[model samples]
Structure formats: structure tokens, C-alpha cells
Target chain A: MKSNDISLPTVPFRTRGGVRVPHRKTTSTCESIVMTVPSQVSIPMQQHIGAPCKPTVKVGDIVCVGQVIGDSDQFVSAPIHATVSGKVLKIADIPMTNGAKCQAVVIASDGLQTPYSELKPPKTDTLDEFLSAVRASGLVGLGGAGFPTHVKLRVPKDKNVDTLVVNGAECEPYITTDHREFLENSENILYAIVKVKEMLNLKRVVIGIEKNKPDAIELMRNLIKKEGKSDYIAVLALKASYPQGGEKVLIEACTGRVVEMGKLPADAGCIVMNVTSLGKLAEYLKTGMPLVTKRLTIAGSAIKEPKNVIVPIGTMIKDVIEFCGGYSEEPKKILMGGPMMGIALTTDELFILKQNNAILAFNEKDARLMETTDCIRCGRCVASCPMGLMPPLISRAVKLNEIEELKSLGAMNCMECGCCSFSCPAGKYIVQTMRTAKAMIRSAK
Target chain B: MVGKLYASSSPHLRQGDTTRKIMLDVIIALLPACIASVVIFGYMSAVLIAVSVVSCVICEYICRRIMKRNNTIGDLSAVVTGILLALNYPVSLSPLIAIGGSVVAIVIVKQMFGGIGQNFVNPALTARIVLLTSFSSKMSNWTEPFAYLNKNAADAVSTATPLADGEHLTSYFDLFFGIHGGCLGETCVLAILLGGIYLVARRVITPLIPLTYMGTVAILSLCFGLDPIYQLLSGGLMLGAVFMATDYTTTPLSNLGRFVFAVGCGLLTMLIRQFGSLPEGVSFSIVIMNILVPYIEKFTRLKPKGFIKPKKESASK
Candidate 1:
């Protein structure tokens, strides 16, 4: 066996366990950006992980650019705004993957460039003023986890936060929109990071980029020198690893602190935000434009032309595909995010929400649906698991219906990072079984 | 490309290891033992092994089909069970008796409880014990190496295995090379070594179970004034340590658990051999340890994150 290609020098910064996934990045990484516009947009009222925003406008109401369509009921949620000047078609429920439907605001674009609200850049701003501007503009993390940026900036009183980590580790296989965003909007990203750090009353800030994307690193380095702010901020080269971009892992990699299990990153005196989220924040702070548009990567073998596109928040994925010259072949799987943590959509009717970063359309040839077999108890899953829990054992406990055994094996501790399932040779849906066990234990508790 | 699309949870990637692949690896590791059994115990040993494997597969198939579950006999785990049972039996055992052991292993011990990992005890060991109790004379019919008139032997002369001497010394090489015989696959030390080495190389069985188990047996036997080498080489020590006790599902979770399990297996095997009614106790010892796996995992519950340090305030207290 070849040992040279397998060893890692920075194990602590990354993880010891990750499968060698086939890289489909070459498909779209070189492609230039292509903007896509849809005839109609159906933006979901709730795209983030928190509470859904309530609709502010009912059916037949005309909504212009930057006009709030759905108002947030909670501070954690981001308000939805119209990407185009349009008349509301309906505010109805659309099917989601969770098997339930969520209310979405549907609008037909009027093909007119209409601006409802605008503001000039402030000459001098305080942290409180900037935060208020961010919250009022309805900016949220555009990097899949639509965490409200302002809320994330609100550091707890008990702990002192000194570092703000920018998550540019787009470790997922196909999605390179983050990689592209870093390359294209380096100034904005750096500015956003500085803005967030200032808001948190922190001086130390680091942009952590996976070594795989050296270009993004180079861009940040050049911009850092050009901006002459290299002392306060630096680019940390994180070893390329799956789930390296996970908040906990990123915290450990950047600041060398383990976010204790069952505790938030904020508990460890750190906050990590995605690079695109920073760019959106920068856009909001500068132009006073509400977050009504997002950058999405349209790639995979099914797409005739693979490229990154800045699309409206509610643009249909099918429209984006058509804008990219339409599909050459039917897709075996159409994922809304990256392959590792992305959700596969059964219908294109599932509009691209604010949280969506990539729309992957892989043909049948791209998918390798492995045949599942009974677990041979190899204990590889146990060894390779990042959370240090035994997946194979817990999965066995589940198979035997031994709930007590499952709990004892720490099934609940599973992060569902998919590392166990990804590395399992038995093709035993070990991750799914672990998730099932965790669910059972949770429900029982 | 156009199959029925289904939405499932994350971790779309799966490990290639399967129960069938694991069982096949075990069978491959048991190859040296099989060869030794055939060489020492004659064609009857080979015939018995074939009978066991076939019977076990058939039984597993029947059980699964009857229960309306997907047939998993193709996984070859039942074959491992069959082979392990056959290795525990004497060469002179009839095909029907071997089949009975296989049936017990697959139908009663394996499928009846839920197949593969769900079995409470090591199925093959349990089956072997059942066979020993049910067919005492046949189970104990030891065949010495080169005893039977066979094509491989230059001279034909019937003899008893070195263990049958009641208490005697034999050359270490003969025992290690498996010149003496007791059971079919248990006759040759050379074959077991080859299989064990293969399994180790493939990483199918960790060294903790076999090494610790054998070490425990050696230490215990030495304390009791028995020849440590003889105790380690005699009967089913190699076969049991390598194949039966290292069973994935029946064993505990961690290395610590495995070490404890192995030590327990070894101690029990030596105790049974020295004081109990059974002259060889590998199967019985492993079955006993299988029952303790759950408790072992419980006691060794990973120490969590804070339970170890108690946040430094406990240090002050």
C-alpha cells in the first residue's frame, strides 16, 4: 500500500478520518460567472434554521426591489425581500423535503429595475449603528446556514471573544461557489470580516481557507497587503478535510479550542461565518440593499454548461439550469447543496431559497449507488468517526433493537457528519442507522 | 440513470465492508486449519467440513425465507459458522451429526435470534457445545495425524493424538506443525498459524483477542504446572483464539473491552480444561464471554468529555 499519499501532517487541525472522494470540481471551477433571471420567483418565508418569517404582503400586492415581502417574527430569522419589481401572485404553501409544506411568497417579475429603498454609505459608523443597519437590511448568512449575522455578532457578556473566523473551506466536493466568491470578492469579504470583528469588539480575525484552493488564499494575501491591515487579520491555511468547514472543527482549527460537546461555538468565545455571508453583509452595509439575491453554483454532469451564477433569492433551479444552456442529459440526482451535506430535490418546484449555495445536477453516470451489506463489524467506522463514538456498535445495537445498548454506545453524540457512512465498506447505511438510533433515544428521553 | 428517486438522510457514502466479506475473510484465515485437518484427520475431515458449510447455509436460507426476510445465506457467514463447528468436531463424526451442528449454528443460534450480528453468543461455539453434549462419543472421536491409511501417508498406522497420552511431552515442532491430532482442523498448528497470520495481515481480526486470549491460557496453564507450550498448542486453542472468540458481533467495543474479553476467554478455557468435565473448553469459554460483552461496553462508557476532569473545581475539592 502507498503510504506517502495517506499520511497527514496536520491531524489535529483537521480530522484523521475522511474518505477519498472523487473530485468533480474541475467541471465548474474554471467556468466564469453567469447571472440567471427567472420569469417568476417563489422565495420561502423561512430559509434559515431558525423561526420562519411571517408574510408582510398578501396576494396581488406589488413589491419593488429591496422591499420587505416577509417580515421576521423573531430576531434570529431574516426578513425576505423582493429581488425584482413584481406583483405578488400568491402566498401559499409549497412542499418541502421535511414532508410538510411551508408558506412561500410567489411573485411575477415585471422586468423593470425598480428600487424601493436606498441609502448612502456612512462616513463614520459605530458598531451599534452598523449592527442596526445590518438587522434592518435583513442580511443573513448566505453560506447555507442562514444564521442572522447581527445575532451572531452579539457576543455573550460572560465570555470575551478575540477571534472572528471566516469559513472559506468549501470542503464539499462539487460546490466551488465559496471558492469563486473568495476569488471574485476578496475586498468585500475582508471588509465584512473586519466589520464583524469590529462589531464584536475583537481585534484578532483570521480567514481560514482549505489548502486545496490556493488561489483564494493568494487573493486574500494580496488584498491583505494592499489594504495594509495584515497585523490584525491573517489567512490560516487549514488542511483540506471534509467537515473542516463545520463550525466546531473550524473553531478548533483556527483557535485551537474544542467546542465542548453539546455547547455552542459562542460558548468557546468564537464565532465563524461563511465567506459569502460576509460578502452579503458587506453589500448590505455599503449599498443598503436588502439580501434579495445570492450567488449559486450551477454544475454537475447533467448541466450542459457549468458555471457560478448570482441569482435572485427565489429563482427556480430549472430556470438557473436553462440559463446555463439547459441540461444536456437528465439528472440522476438534483441536489440543492454540496454532495456531502446537501439535500437532493425530487422536484424542481423546490425553489432556491436564501440558504441554497449550489444547485448540483448529476447525471446517472455521476452517482455510484453502492450495494448495502450486513456490517462485518470491521470497527473501521468506530476508528474513523470524528466524534469518537462507535458507529458500527451503535448501528448493531439498533439492529438488535437494544435501546439501552444504543444509548450506552453514545448514539446521541453522533454529529451525523456522514464520516462513518462515507467510510463504511459494508455499505451498511451505518450513518442512517446511527441517526435512527439517536432519534429513538432522543424521542425516548 | 432513471431509477426510482428516493430522498434519504446524509452520509451518502458507505464503507465497502460487508458481513459476507468478513465471513469470507474468516474462512480464508481458517484455510490452514482446514488443510491441517484434512491432512491429519484424513478425507473424513474434509467431508465433514463440506457437510457443515452446506447445512449451515441451507438452514440460514430456510430460516430467513420462512421469516419473510431477505435471504442472506449468500453472505457466507453461515459458512464460517459451519467450518468453525466442523473444526471443533472429530473427523469420525457422521455427516448428519455435522449437519446438526450447522443447523444449530444457523437456525437456532443465528437466525432464530436474528441473523449475523444479532446472535447472543458465538453461534459456531454454541453449536459445537450443543453437538458435544448431544453426541458425546462421536464429538470426542480424536484422530491422530497419519493414523488412517491415506494417499498422503507413506506408512499406515493407527494412533492417538499427543493429548490422548494423559500427560506427556511431545516435540514443540510436531505440535506447532500440527503432527498430532484431536479434532479435524484443530490437528495442525501450522495451518492455524497461516490462517491467523492471513487474518492479521488483512486486519479482519485484531491481535488483542487472539494474543490476549492465548497469553491468558499460557499464563494460567503455567501457574497450574502444565507445560505452557503444550497448553497453548494443544486441542482447539489456535482455532478458538483466531476464529471463534474474535467474532466481531459477539465481542466488546473497545480495545480495553477486547483485552478483558480475551483474558476472560483464556482464563475460562484453562479453568474448564484443568478442573471442569470438558477436557477442551475454548467453545464454552467464548460463549460465556459473549454474554458479558454488553456489560463490558457499559462499564467502559467512553468517559464523556468532562467526567474525567470535572472542570478543575473538583481538583480543588
Candidate 2:
């Protein structure tokens, strides 16, 4: 499966209510910064949010850069690969993002990354072969969900997908690696989109981007226009909204079709893929390399210098921090994703994964939580929530541990967009409580 | 540069809105009514408003500082409470009572209960009730609006307000245009309407509560031949429908909740007006309905999707 220049259609979609988040894009999105493989790479088996992948290779086993070290039997889990041709030093539990230890494969890099088996084009050109190839390569969604890509590509027979939506929205604040990747590797991504289309046997493909990033929109538009393929492949410029990058919201905004809650986009006759994922797919198809590296945004107010670093998957957070000139001061908190939805990592020993999009090193000021006071009943939360859920009322129920009230109030439907919390004047933790409420409701069920 | 990143609760964005801004908007929305009161009731309206606003501000400042709390009277909520309380009183009421009402609203009702958004009851309504019960004579003293005007005199005639226009209800034009005299705010229909329009346009408050409340009352009164126009233009109905009934702190949370609250306020207002001892019933009705807000919200809760669906079972299970 070499990179074939095949014609494919790009579907354009809209985005919901976006806040004007400070870009910090110039520091990271302007150029690609590739970090050298660390001397000792601590590769975690279960970096993404899913069932932990079991280690296939043990401690003291010599492994090459592309060799799979961790593979899971579960369909939802992903495998971990060695980043450098190296000797495995340890296979033990280490700190992860969720405040618990997970098994990791630690290797001492030999400074030579020659693969044990040289990567070549896929031997077969069938859909099954492509699926097997994708499974072998260990690629996930890469836009942060980290769902096994092979699983997503396997469309259910009941739902017929007419278009493949490539989400280039990159709508999250302080993250611009996807924008940079699209500008640098538009052709590669296009090839990946075509391959996806071929696999799905779909005729149309679309790329949705927010209008704020005019450069990305203009670049993609010009690239498609220059190829004289505007009809088949087009760029859609969506109005800016936070969480507009979410799969369901993006589907609704772009296609004007509401994918009912608890249903996939396929239920709405659509499949969404992030631009970075498609770019990696293109690379995998062309070079037959396993998913070993990813583009991550290293940003926040505390970092000395913020930039997008192309680091091998499983690289330690500490190493990445050093590569970014270390923290301006000891960061008050380290976050694994964007501010609105990111998980707070207690320790910086967490490893980067395909799903890890950004590492935010925020100082005390950035991590300051508003002291929740009495609910002012401003109804601002009601007005600002894109999902149309009343956050303050739901939060009240959650704080009182009223699960039934939460369920009735549609607490389960909250996308955790943080719009309610963002707009609140009483400083109540609306989203946090809603998250807890959602968890309680799900567990009760 | 090493900058201190502000760590707040979950939501970091404030939308640049503050209690002060909302209170300021409330005060601004009340401007037309204040001006109308001054024009119709002469210098008495101006003095009462000034005395009430100043007393409330001073009392709020003292209470907040004495409690070692953030002095949020700067937010102008005290000013709003002050103005609303004063507007509820008669133009003939001594400036001392207006100031006293301001103190009661700002100190006893608002600040004592935790300031701004913390009060369980509408501060203005609480103060008005307190004053009415405490000084019935002052509260109910309805005057000729401008010191017993004689028809032969050159000065403008300030007839007893619509409710007090003897047996016949005042003309629709006189009521709509604010010719009759009542309390500082209740006297002017045009002023209240203009303020409501401004509030709606600025998104300070939704039209649901005001429109629904007024619409329900007008429809019911009209059906009973109670003169919808005069009913709308009379007493505290316009002011209460536009302002006090829409108090964010005491009202329901959802659009549906607000609608229900408005409807309830309307029905209660009409029932009390037609049957109760009082000529007007807006104040008592709002207070009564405020008690049902939590229950109203509960009954009107929005059911989120997939809330009722059972989780999918694994193939192994």
C-alpha cells in the first residue's frame, strides 16, 4: 500500500460556540520541533484511556525501534512500540496520568534506531489487509480519544456511511500541532483520506476547520483548488467554538445533523477522523512504519519556551519538559490535555502516547480554582451551555448526591464542555460536579 | 517570564460579567421609572430615590466591612435593592421611611443573609413587606399625588392613582401615558415598559418571565371584564412584572421554570387583586411564588438523552 495519488472528496462541516482562547500558536504551530530520543525511554503499556495493554516483551529483552513491546488481547487497547533500537532495562509499574501506576517498558537507547524488520509497503491491497496492517502498526485515533483506529474503520453493516469527515478543527486552546501538521503534510493527509475512503468504499470525504485559523483554511483550500478538485475535496471554515472539536458537535455543525446522544456518527451516516490521525495513516500506508511517534503541544504559562515537539510515543514527561527548556518555575500542576477537559497529572513521570495531545505546565495562577460559593442562580450557565443543560441546578443535585435528580436534569447529556462553569459568576464547579454526577448516574445504572 | 497562572475552580473564563455590572444594569433599567416619578410626583420622588439609594449604599458598606467580608456594595446590588424598595413605597412617604426601607433591604434582608445572590427571598420585596407590616399608616397613605391639587389651580393635577380613581377605572390613555399618581415606580407605565425593553435587548433578562406574567394577568383580567389595559397600567403590576418577578437569585433556573414562575406570579397576582384585601397584589404574589421556585425547577427538570436507557451488555455476559 504505497502512497497512491488518488482523487477523494472532502466533506465540510460546521463548529459550535467557541471562546477566544489565547492562541500561543506562534510558539508551537510555526515550526515542527523533533526531540532526540532520550537515553532511557520509559514506555508505558497503557497510556491511553482504555484497558491496559499487556507487555509482550519482558525486561532484558533487546528490541528495535519499530518492534512491538506491548500488545493487548482486547480490541479497544493499543500496543506500545520501542522508540529506539535498545536493550530493555525494566518492565515495572510507574506513575501515569490517572494518579496510579501502570506497567511500563523501560529501555536504554543504543542511539541507533534500525528496525529489526525493515518496513515495506503492505503486501496486500484488500480491506482486510489494510485492517491487519493498521492493527500491526499500533495506530490509534491520535486526536486524543486513542481508540484503536482499526476498530473505528470497521463500520457496522447496519449504518451506511456516505462521507468520511476529517476533523482539522484543532479547536482546543493552547494546542496547534494538528494545524502545523496539516500545513506541512497536506498531501500525505489527503492520501490517507483517500485510503480511508477506499477502505470504507465511500465516495465523499470532508475536512472541517474552524475559521479562526485562516491560514490552515486558506492553505487547505488553495491546495484543493490548485489540484482542480474543489467538487470532490473541499475545505469548510467553521465558526469558532470551544469543544467544537468534539466528534458529535462537529458532525452537527458541519452536516447540520444531530447525532443522538449515546450514538456514534455512523448513526448519522458519518465517520470523523482528526487530521493528525489521517496524516499518520498516510505515513503508515507509504512507509509501513508502526505508530511510534506523535506531534504534541508543550505549552502553558509556566514553560520557559512553548513549542510543538515531535516526540516518540512513551517518552517521559520529564524529558519533554527539559526539551522545552524546563519550567519557568516549578509548575503548580501538570495537565495532560487542554484546560477545559484535560486530566491533571500528579507526577510528571507520565509518558506521552498517541492520544496525548498537549502537556500543560501551569503555574499557581493558571491552576487557581474558583472558590465555589452559593449558587447565584444567574442562569448564565443555562444560556451559555451549548448542550442546553442547566448546569447550576444539575450541580446542586450532584453536590447533594441526588442521582435521580441529576438523571432527570439531563446530567448524563453534559459533554463537559465547561461552558457553564466558564460563564458562572458564583465560582461554582459546575462541570466538575456534573462529571461526578455523570459518573454516579452511570455507575448506578 | 515566570507568571503566576491563576488556578481557579473548574471554569476559568468570567465573561467579564460581575454582580456590579448586573446591578448597574438593573439600576439603568429603572432609570426611566425614576425619571417618570420625579416628573409626576415632583421633588418628593427625587428626594425619596436619593435618600433610599444613599442609605442602602451606606448600610451595605457598613455591614460588609463589619463582617469582614468582601464589600460587594460596590457591585451596586445594594443600590438596586434600595431603588426597588423605594419605588415600592408611596411618593408621599417621608424620605425617612425610604431610607429606613433601604437599610432594612440592604442590611437585614440582603447582607445578613449573605449578600448579592445569597438571599433566599427578594431583598426589595422582603423590605417592602417588613415596612408594610411595621408602618401600615405610612405604607398605605395614598395622597392626591401632588399635595391635594385643585382643578382651578394652574399646577398639574396629580389625581389619586388608577386603583384609587374612585368607582371608575382611569382612562386607558392616562394610565398608559403615566398621568395618574401611585408609588415612585408604579405610577409610570411607559417608563416600566421602556426599561423592560432595554433589559430584554441587552439580554439582562429574558422576555419569558415578564411577558408570560403580564400576558397571563392581562388575559385573565380581560376575560373577567376587569379591563386588561387598566389592570396592566395600574398599581405595582407593571413594575413587579418587569423587575421584581424576574429576580435571578430567587427565580427558577430553566426557561420552562421561568415560564412557570411567571404564570404562577400572574395567576396569584390576579386572584389576590380581585379577591384579597389589597387593591394591588403584585408584591405578595411574587413573594408567595418565590417559595415554590425550587419545587417548580424540580418538576420542570430537563431529561437528558440516554438517561433512561440501560447499558449495553458484553457478549460474554
List the global CA lDDT of all models: 0.75, 0.77
Per-residue lDDT, model 2, residue B37, is 81
Compute the lDDT of residue A411 as modeled in candidate 2: 72
Q: Which candidate ranks first by DockQ, i.e. highest?
A: 2
- C-alpha DockQ of every model: 0.26, 0.31
lDDT of 2: 0.77
Q: Residue B92 in candidate 2 has what lDDT?
A: 70
Q: Candidate 1, residues B1-317: lDDT per residue as tens digits?
A: 23444355665444455666777888888887888777776787789889988888889888988999997878888888888888888777789888888878888888888787788798888888898888887777665576676657543343555655676666888888877757778767778878888888987876888999999988998899989898888878888888888888898766778888999999999999899876778888889999998898767545332112223333667
Position A89, candidate 1: lDDT = 96
Give the alpha carbon lDDT tens digit for every residue of A285-344 in model 2: 888787888888888887888888989877888899899999997688777877777777
Ten-residue region with minimum lDDT total, candidate 2 chain A:
A1-10
Report the lDDT tens digits of candidate 2 across residue range B83-200.
Answer: 8888888777788877778877888877888887777788889889888989977787754544534456544333555775546556777777676667778877899999999999
